[model samples]
Target: MDVSAETLIKLYVTMQRIRLFEERVADLVSKGEITTPCHLYTGQEAVATGICASLRNDDYVFSTHRSHGHYIAKGGDLRKLMAEIYCKSTGCSKGRGGSMHITSAEKGLPGSSAIVAGTIPIAVGAALRLSAVGGDGVSVAFFGDGAVCEGAFYEALNFASLKKLPVIFVCENNLFSTHMPVEDSLANPIIYKIAEAFKLPSCRIDGNDVLKVYKTGQAAIERARKRKGPSFIECMTYRWRGHVGPNYDVDKGIRTQKELDRWMAKDPIKALEKMLIAKRFLTNGEASKIVTGIEREIDGAVAFAKKSPYPPSDEMEIIRYLFR
Candidate 1:
């Protein structure tokens, strides 16, 4: 894959926006401003930014409980997302759907669900719909490693392969299902093998490396767009926080400090920054300016969400049947 100065800058900006947005959300949740169970995608920003960079506006993308990074990567509005997290009336889901359920239909993020692998079949069905229409639309499913153990992931893969649906099943293998490591949960723990069994092409890459993720994603997305078939990518990454909170004990037995330090060395944002500097895309000063600008934008979004009123009591009553 060729990297130009402009493309590198765009990636840097998108990753920065996602990182800052999640950091701010963590603060908001910590302060008790947001009541919903919040999941921050701080350590997994690279997967979303890299993969979504290779997609088009019309291509569908599905995400899991830890979905903020995917939503932001697919051109979702930060103000509306923050509003949704805060449960304000102006939110993307009109404040009814909290953080985990955020969606942007216009950007092809139909919605996310709490159930693991819930969106796999949904993406497959959407891919089938696109196939019927003979459209160029492709669907991407972002799920955790735990979701791969679910019946839905395998069933959807089989169905999509039988019909050659234009879908990309991406497993964001953070090595844990909530508090438990994936090893304790499954025998054949490798996600790519599951896709291979379904007769689909699969690629396993270092999810922390943004360039590798982007290149692999580009190839898979291109294959799907051409109506060849579905593809799978197992992204080996980690989440810095607990399964459902902002912060936790670093010395906790669930995750070790040594692993954290190793992953920190491969920070996607910093890696891209070094690349940009080496390529002369921008100097230290320019990079600082860009970071400052994104911080300001995120602050503005937070202010917008905070000032926005919560849903009226009667309005909440009207939206109870949204799924129906």
Candidate 2:
């Protein structure tokens, strides 16, 4: 697709920023700096970066537990995200919502839910509202393969189809949902086919290829914006970390090292870097500089999070609804 050099470079930078941020979060988690049960979005950066690139600042995006990449790619403030994970008062959710529940309406990320398919219906509602107001804005819901098994997933799809809501359902099918492989969990492992049952336009693409993802996402977003109704995109990607920690799950015998190595070899960040280099959009020195800049940005965000104060004990009263 005849994409401009500037766009390609931006995609590369965004993916790199996510990779660096997630890596730093992993380090902080290991050092007890972030006590939240974190889910790293290391290997799945391309999917979020490419898809969010197609969305407007006003477009709504609902995310899942693995959402740092989604939030960052959707223009969320890096410092506030770090603070949220650190449980500081200056967080986007005011320190009440940790890693799994970060939300920024200003950035168009309404919220992310830890529940498997929790945000599906929320995105549908957002899209329905947008349609009622006669706007072209689209809402996107990002979920994993595990969420497809949830009844909520089917219900959301059925409603979206019936209403012709302006929404995009993106499933980051990374082969395994937690410890179970997709093959073992589903009678028919092809996820995009489920969308076909809803009579929605759908396709699966290589999530490791940022450009491919961008092209597909652009088409889907344009379709929604034009009031063509919901489309489903199944991005074939992988998570480099375990389900809820910073370590590789291969050590637990859930996934083989060979499988992890294969996906790592197809690293989305590296793929984009190589493509940019090949297209003369960037050189080795320039790529290195970009990486350095991202590292500095991450360092600054960490410093901000560390210096931010935690919420006062009395503030617990503000969250009294949780007790009931």
Q: Pick the candidate with the highest TM-score.
A: 2
lDDT of 1 by residue, 108-211 (tens): 89999899999999999989998889878899999999997799988999999999999988899998898888999889888798789989998789998888
Q: Any runs in candidate 2 off by more than 4 Å, and if so which?
A: 315-324
Q: What is the C-alpha lDDT profile of model 2 across 19-96, one tens digit per residue?
A: 999989999889888899899999999999999998988999999999899999998999999999999989888798
How many residue pairs of model 1 clash at the backbone?
0
Give the poorly placed runs of model 1, Cα more than 4 Å off.
249-251, 315-324
Candidate 1, residue 193: Cα displacement in angstroms equals 1.4
lDDT of 1 at 168: 89
As for candidate 1, its clashing pairs are: none
lDDT of each: 0.88, 0.93
TM-score of each: 0.96, 0.97
| Prediction-by-prediction clash tally | 0, 0
